[model samples]
Structures are given as structure tokens and as C-alpha cells.
Target: MRKDRMILRTPLPDRLCHWAMVVCFFLVALSGLSWLFPSLNWLNGVFGTPQMARVLHPFFGIVVFAALVYLFIRFVKYNLFEKEDRIWLENVKSVTAGDHSKPLRIGKYNAGQKFMFWGIMGLICVLLISGLVIWRAYFAHLFPIPVLRVALLLHAVAGVGLMLLIIGHIYLAFWVKGSIRGMVTGYVSHAWARAHHDRWHDQISGKGADKTKPGSAR
Candidate 1:
């Protein structure tokens, strides 16, 4: 697509951060699972050696948390809920069926996307705190055995929850034809923007005025 005809959906820095986080998250998740289940023990070899995986897992998890923090700062405005979000929520069944006959008045993100954004942010926060408490190399000694055990349980639950959310996110990205491309190239065709995010497209193209300011729905 021509540059002039495409809209910027993600900026270069944000795209880079997202992809980098994905890589680190994969490593961290595999190592975490390896430790959680004996059948998945070999998965730790993703870091070259099981011993290395143990040493690097927490560091990689930290990197993932930092990257998510950066993304939250950059994209939170666009993901915030607005009154029109109820329209998308109310018609989610039709939206999921690939029907766009009506104007959903979606912002840069739809209600579903906002849910994902907050879900991820919330899970990562849990993971970070729990991981820190259970981190054997550093802070584990600072906590009582009971506290450490509780932190370990929370960490495991949050990790599994985050992985599930990411899987859903990946599924939806592929379900929406141009979503991955927009993330990779930082642009989406005007038609794509219009179909998926009419309100955002209108705000960007000046076709209609919105109650909220540009680049945000709230």
C-alpha cells in the first residue's frame, strides 16, 4: 500500500518494543513451563541449557515486564474506554462473525482490545510482584517460607493466565487480516482502518469530529 494512503497504526519504537518483548516472553514462558511440569522439562533448553534457563528466566521476565510497562505508557490513551465502546460491546457477536454492517464507533481499539490491554497489564503486574518475591537469587531470602510459597503460587497462576491471554491475542491478530501487518509495518490501509476502527479512521482522516481528542477515545 502507498504510504500516503495508509494510516500509522503503530509507531516504529512501539513496534520494536512489542516484538522484542515477544521474544523475551517466549523464552521466559518456556522456562517457566519447564519448571512447572516434568514432561516439559526439555523446553528449558531454549536458553541453551537447563541451568542457564534457571539463571536467565527471571531476568527475561523482568525484561518482559519493562517492555510491557513501556507499551502501557504509549498505548493506554488509545485503549481507554469511551461511551461508544458500549456499542461495540453490545454487538460483539456480530463483530466476531466478521459483520460490519453497522457503525460500531470503535476507537483505535475496540472494547475487546481494551479488555485485552487491561487484562495483560493487570497480569503482568501480578507476575512482576510475585516473581520478585519468589526470585531465589535475590529477594526470596527476605520473605518467610509461607510468604514465598504464596508468591510462588501467584506467580505460576499469573504466568499461565498471561500465556493464555497472549494465545488469544495471537488468534485475534490472525483473525483480523491486517492486524499483524499493521504491527509489523506500523501502518494499515485506509480501508482496513475504516472497517476495524471507524471512529479512529474518521478522526485520523478528518471525516467526522469526535468528542474525544485525536489519537484517543477518552
Candidate 2:
């Protein structure tokens, strides 16, 4: 693990925000789920007491939203779709089988990662809007009961959806050998980047490889 061979993958601010948001998200999610499920009611103890959980859940949710907004601004450019993404999508089976023979021309983030990025961003925005609408201590009174009811429904749905996306994210992060290490240490081995994101590796290393022509599915 020579330091010289590692490439900066995640910056310090983004890593800090990401882990901090993970903590806040779990706390808020567990507390909210406690209310939604009779058997999971004990989860409200996440904030020490059920009453305190109710008081702090909204605040924690706001923190998660803020962290995500910061991440979105920082990473959205890298996560945008590109022509090469179609190749990656088409070779989805090969990716899952750990076969990298195809010149997928993957950049900093692959098509699957790009999809997850947008999914997380879109779901978080939904959660924020609905959370604000149903925030009992502050905004709920501003809206009619009907609107509040609808907001509560949408908030719950968005929360579960975001949690599902996050579960998939966690799974893939661990499944990819160097991904979690990159997030934690802000770096990845050159070989890992070259194997997983060849185009990005080429761009950063100035390898001068020809770009994959558009519509070249192979």
C-alpha cells in the first residue's frame, strides 16, 4: 500500500459530511420507524426517550438533508450521465460477474453509481419537502389537516424509499473492494481506479488513450 500509488478519490469535506449524514440518517430513520411499526417502537430510544425522539427527529432529518445538499453540489457533475454510460448499462451482467474485459469507458462514477446518486438526491429532496410540511412543532399548523395527512404519507414513503436506496448503496460500497476505503481515506490505489474507472484513470494520468467513439456498443 504505497502512498504514492494512491489517487485522491473523495475529498476530506465530502467524506466528513457523508459519515456525519449516515449517523444522522440512521438516528432519524429509526425514530421515525418506531412510530410506524408497533414492534419497532423501542427504536425510539435512539434519542434516549420517545418524547425526545419526537422532538429531535425533525432536526436530525434537517441535518441529513443539509449534508446531502452539500454532497449533491460537490458530486453531481461527476455523476451526470454520458454516452459511455449506455455501454455500462448494456454490460450490466458482466459488471455483476466481475468481468472487466469490455472497454466500458467508465469515468469517475459508473452508470449504476450515477443512478444511485440521482435516486438519493431525488428521494432526499422529497423527504425534505414532505418533512417540512408535516413538521408538527413548526409548519404543520400552517397547513390544513388534509394537507398534513398527505404530507405525512409522502414523507413516510420517501423515507422508506431513501432507506432502500441507501441499503443498496451500502451493499455496493462493501461489495466493491476499495470503495469504502476510498470514502474513509480519501484515496484509492491506481490499479483499483484503472480497473474500475478506466476513463477516469486515463484522464487523470494523461494516458492519451483514444476516447470511445459514440454508438460503439462493444
lDDT winner among the candidates? 1
**TM-score of candidate 2 against the unseen true structure:** 0.93
Model 2 lDDT, full chain set: 0.87
lDDT of 2 by residue, 1-218 (tens): 67666777787888999999999999999998999899999898999999999999999999998998899988888898999899999999999999988788998899999999999999888899999999888888999999988998999899889888889999999999999999998888888987899888877775653334211111
| lDDT of model 2 at position 186 | 85
Tens-place lDDT per residue, model 1, 1-218, is: 78766777887899999999999999999999999999998898999998999899999999999999999999998888899999999999999999998999988999999999999999999999999998888999999999999999999999999999999999999999999999999888988988999988888776665433333332
Query: Positional deviation of 78 in candidate 1, in angstroms?
Result: 0.9
Candidate 2: Cα lDDT at 38: 94
